[model samples]
Target: MLLEDHQLQSIQWTELSRGISFGVDGGCLVEAVERLGLVDIVTVSIVPGGQIVLEAPLGNAAAYWHPCFDPGDSLPADWAGRERFSAVRSAPIGVLVDANGQSSFAFSFDCLTQEGEIEFGASEEAKTFVVRLAITDGLAAARSTVRLAVVAPELAHEQAVRELSVLLHDGIAGRQASEIAREPVYSSWYAYSQQISHDVIMRNASVASGIGCKSVFLDDGWQKFGDGRWYAGCGDWVPDTAKFPDLRGTVAELNAAGLQAVMWIAPFLIGEQSAAYSGLARYATHYSEHLRTWVLDPRHREVREHLVAVCTRLMRDYALDGLKIDFLNDVMNYAGTPSTGDVPDVGDAMTLVLSEIAQALESVRPGSLIEFRQPYISPAVAPFADVIRANDCPADADQNRRSTLNLRLLAISQVVHSDPIMWDPSAPVEAVSRQLLNVFFSVPQISMPLDVLPEAHRARAAELLTQWRALRDVLLGGELSVGLPNEGYPVVSSRLGSTLVVAAYQPRLLDLDLEGVSELVILNSTASSALPYTVFGDVPPVGSALAEGETAARVVEFAERGFVEVPAWGITRITLGA
Candidate 1:
């Protein structure tokens, strides 16, 4: 059912004749309405005496889904659900889907300020679902416009989410990504975490370059001595002479080994032990007990210039290919130092800092890569971010797969990457294989100590990386479809030209479209040996031609449907017999 303007206004506590100013705090002054068929576009001009809060009610919501909530989180057992949900400048959208995978109601808020809170609950008096949006900071003295949209209910949940991304992207000035941003990467985090040196990375880079990795991310521990302080040494961007005596020379060595070098930096963190902390502690906005670091206030002109200089200097001095900026979501408002800077809103200040850094880096080196991670995966940062990866799910293959898909569905135009895939050296071969196959839809990042891997594990890693390198164009750039997300997206497939690749996570009958297809590759991610498939068009019978990592092809001919008995956690390639 389409929600008309009158219906929306009627549900609100304030009565709107021309425009309502019913509250002493953040009250509306003017209202302009534009109709986009089924979707309603309502623009409100607010004069903020305090924080602004708006509530929208939906009567048909069955399940609520948002980017901040992981797909693996527990679902609602009854009418009780999460009491409060929040969105930062990083992630600012959510949707309500019915049981049939159709979006019942959706909201995308233009909270270009500090942070916004969304509360979801059942209204007992009204018997409806309520979504409340509150913008707590960054209100301008001039007219601050809030664009609230309720999307069409007819769209599939995926389509609805994609449209929301497009809506958000239309408001930002973003840049294009470089060619190398989509390549396979080898990171030094899980393998050696905080205990790396020049020799260790070069050894792994050589092995990674030989096995099809195009880039290496030098994670933490490259910049400070090993005093066991987590982030107390983060603010200073200088490399520790003890760990990497020749930073410039080490970068050259990586480039000589056919790999691009990307350095990691927490640009907003001011470690308590660093000299900058002593001078700039007054500019800090919050303190994090977990990392033992203070969040630098980006609103200050000095603070912004310092971070921009720090990032761009690395690009110029080291001739670096890119930077992996971390912990941007930690830059929100938290009542730290008073706001005494040129930029009024912290959200706008954060945006300005990232934009200036990207602009400056481009002057130093054109097509320099910048990466952001999961909860920070919004089109707002797409102007500077070339890659958006899953959050750190080190050894869990399923979490990597699910997180990448969630990011891909929302940030449709951005290049999505899996978290660095890591595993124990003595893990089973099937477990290692699942790690590679699960991240096929997105760019894969391996964080293993390749030089010291078990012989069998190293061989398998090399073989799968080689295979992924060959099919990356199809896997990353093809038309993709996902099965029921409520069921944890058990089946995902992609097609480019005539090549089709489908990954099945659960043992179920695969219903596929086979019009004008020359090749089919089934990635069995589960332990089921029999993969059952039924083709949907006028297609000829097919034969199993190649079974990877297995001795021979074992097939069973069931006249009713095609079934290939693949090894547990293996890949099978089939050719159509015309």
Candidate 2:
């Protein structure tokens, strides 16, 4: 309902719901574009420096590619200096490109004119600008690349317009059913190993409400496990008496604890001993036989109906809030043959299954949050999901670090972003806290296990979530600013009005001209102390080409200074009035 039209000095923009038109002031560009339907578009200016190139993403031919770093491939000498900013996360945030190829950032959504405040004018007071993009429905995509495009609103909607109109016809090629508008994210039960206990679930949920977190998910090990089967004989959703002791009692307690109970369910993968499999079951697809554990025969109307019925009973009988639909790895490269000669669109099959499951859940509880973990099919899954998990967390710090790179890279290349609520690994308290803080640079929840944490972690989790909930609105809704990252550590800062949130990892120096910024929040991930908080009007006088327009101020560091050294791995907040 809100529309923003920036007045570019070089062009005048006109907009209508049907399409857009543009006119030029002193050039032929507008004249050519106006005839071609380019108007009110997100604009990108290619500053000639930093040898960054833009390529078209695989499926989307309209957008351009960007700068990249390949740890796997040997590159030309000094590759870092010769590149463009291929920062997809920063796409929503303003990015700074330096002459020597390094990039810093400052996100200023506000525009202004000569007067103090300009209404919808090119002034610093008005704030609202975003890249326009359209998501097409029923894509015939194999893989996708992250390509950034400077788009106008009209252009963004135009490209995605087809998706809105396309209707899914049952078993008719790729399209399956009508779409809905709610965005979704999925839930997971701490990777594949669910070792969760009833008491642990209740303890976690009790605190989840205090931190304003929702979705009390009782992950793993609840189903009765039988002999000679790892995950078999557990397809039926019966609580393990050994684990739950009083299963119904536990569900009742969770409801009273102010948490929406969400249980994890893997649709397929029946163990050989499972009652459903022990009796007699036909392969859903001939390919299901090849899968490790038994794959559910979703193609069978009975199987689909039974799956829906069980899920519905959890709500109707148990009063559970939602379900964490897990283990979709089956579709990862699955090329199964249906019974007939007609092959189903692999993408369509995935979509249909998702649609059916989503419909079943909604019919039971109109507002239930259906979460899934499909980082691979993120772009496709994003529109339909309520929550999306980035991926299962690896067990150690090194793997945890790799997850960051993979997750960030995935966010860009796939052109989709998701938050992983898995607990921060048993890392150094500071490391864990700062890691969570940085993840908050984008909108993600801090879903960590606080019950078993040692003293420091418990304190950090409580303090971090407390502060996060108090400022989540600002973090989720404010303008973003990111700085150049160093090896092993990174820094990103954001501001919403007078409140400033800055999170820094490892020990380092951050000197940037936060033009209108009046605050600072620092989260030091390193065990050592950092210097001081004095401001300097320029980039550090290091061995470099600090450009002419790059005005900056340094917050002086006091080595061995007592008060200003940020806590090892603690989030700190500061306020500045501009």
Candidate 3:
């Protein structure tokens, strides 16, 4: 394997089957080769410092891939080829940590065109940390290059992330920026699903505006014949007069109500019943049995132009504020289909289409928001999107948090958003608050029907959303700290200058150094009625505090020396004295 430190010894390959070979090329590139009809595994061992921090492409899926632990022990042989919605879960980057929680070494894939995975596990027999690079599909027969670096242990995590970002940016082509990247949005997917109408949308937009949501996204059911069939009206890109007699008027009404209008569109998918489906048969990548639709081949210039034109017209015709592009990952090249254009790979083609769409839309509506989700969330496509949201996890709060953090760590300057929060409205206020707390670090998109919510739920939601808006700047742009994967991120906090915001997902003792912190707001996500915390540093005992939600007034002060308890599932703002 390639080593950053020349003094380091060569990698010892414990198991190298006959069909595969490893070598160093140009004194820098580490090349691994596998012949036809052979499944090979390459293993390397190293002794890292104190705690090892493994960075996975996606969120924590302990059963499949763990950052510091070996998921191979329980992983099935077919795990490498297992069908999944995202490829980040199997991304080829692994960061090694030193004793003091600093980065010691890191391994990354320089080639973005191929699909691969780097799995780590402790080798008890070898007494050294083992990493297995599992390359398959496109790279199985061809050569694959993996880059290794020995980072200085003194490098801070943020610095390391910045460095990594630069490296990735150099390798990729675009960066994303938008004014609405961090703004709160209201989505109709979870709330209305396929059952949507002009009245429902206008009603939701009015309510969303009252709660400080800046944008209203009409998702999935606006196009003609877009009812039960998800993409039946996809390629046409025309409004369904049945659902809304005047689509333009609906958008105008939303704008009148003080909400930016955003719509969801899938550019690379064509329903079988669509008029263009039969005519564009040559542009089909493959007929997806799962989606029951034809995935458009993005490599074709004609197809890319069509997508760009459709998006530009939406902005020019309806005066939309943004477009949420869904199912972008479907445009990737499949094994059996040969590309129809000069593009070398489908990824490059996908990026090209995205760039064109972004440019065209922005030209019509400057600063228009373009949003994408996981799988297609690589640095290469960042330039084409203003907001990158976590893949849909529905009511699972932990997964939503983990996904949001994963995107935030990689997307860097881009707005990272949580999956639309859709929970049972009848649930306890505390439980509902837990869902909100999980995604507190990123932009929150609410997708529930607030009009039908209970009075108590409505009040609680309003209070939390108001508080969220008050702290939006710091929470979105501040220095962030997250609990390790092992702990399931029970605590996540962000600090901007002297102001700190902390969200506790579990009942754990939290210690904060309030040296420069003037205002500390703690949000408890636990089920308990109160949250116990400790504060130290240059701050004195709390003088006065305001508790909103279920928090009782008496529990605001530090009940036990240095320990302060606040109401659970609510926000508590604590003022510190010098």
Q: Give the per-residue lDDT of model 3 (tens digit) for 498-537.
A: 8998888888777676677778888888766555566664
TM-score of candidate 3 relative to the true fold: 0.81
Q: Once superposed on the true structure, which residue ranges of model 3 sit more than 4 Å away at CA? A: 1-91, 96-105, 124-127, 132-150, 154-162, 170-176, 229-233, 333-337, 530-542, 549-562
> What are the per-model numbers of colliding residue pairs?
1, 47, 2
Using all chains and alpha carbons, the TM-scores for the candidates as numbered come to 0.87, 0.59, 0.81
Candidate 2 lDDT by residue in tens digits, 1-578: 01222223324444322322222222212211122132122222221111111111111111111112222221211112122110001112122222222221111111000001101101122221212211111111221211221222322221222111121111223222112111111223442245666766766665555554554566666777722224556567777777778766787887776555677777655656567775324643323334446665444455556677777777666676666676664533333333221223344444556667777777787766665553322333434445444455433332233333333332321221234445445666655454456555433444456555466665655566666656664554554443332132244445687555655554545544444555555655556555333344443212111111124433433222224544455554443331
**lDDT of model 2, residue 155:** 25
For this target, which candidate reaches the highest TM-score against the unseen true structure?
Answer: 1
Which 10 consecutive positions of candidate 3 have the poorest summed lDDT? 46-55
- Provide the clash count, candidate 2: 47
Top candidate (lDDT):
1
Global lDDT for candidate 3? 0.64
Overall local distance difference test of candidate 2:
0.41
In angstroms, give how far residue 21 of model 3 lies from its true place: 18
Indicate whether candidate 2 or candidate 3 has the larger TM-score: 3
Of the two candidates 1 and 2, the one with more favorable lDDT, higher being better, is 1
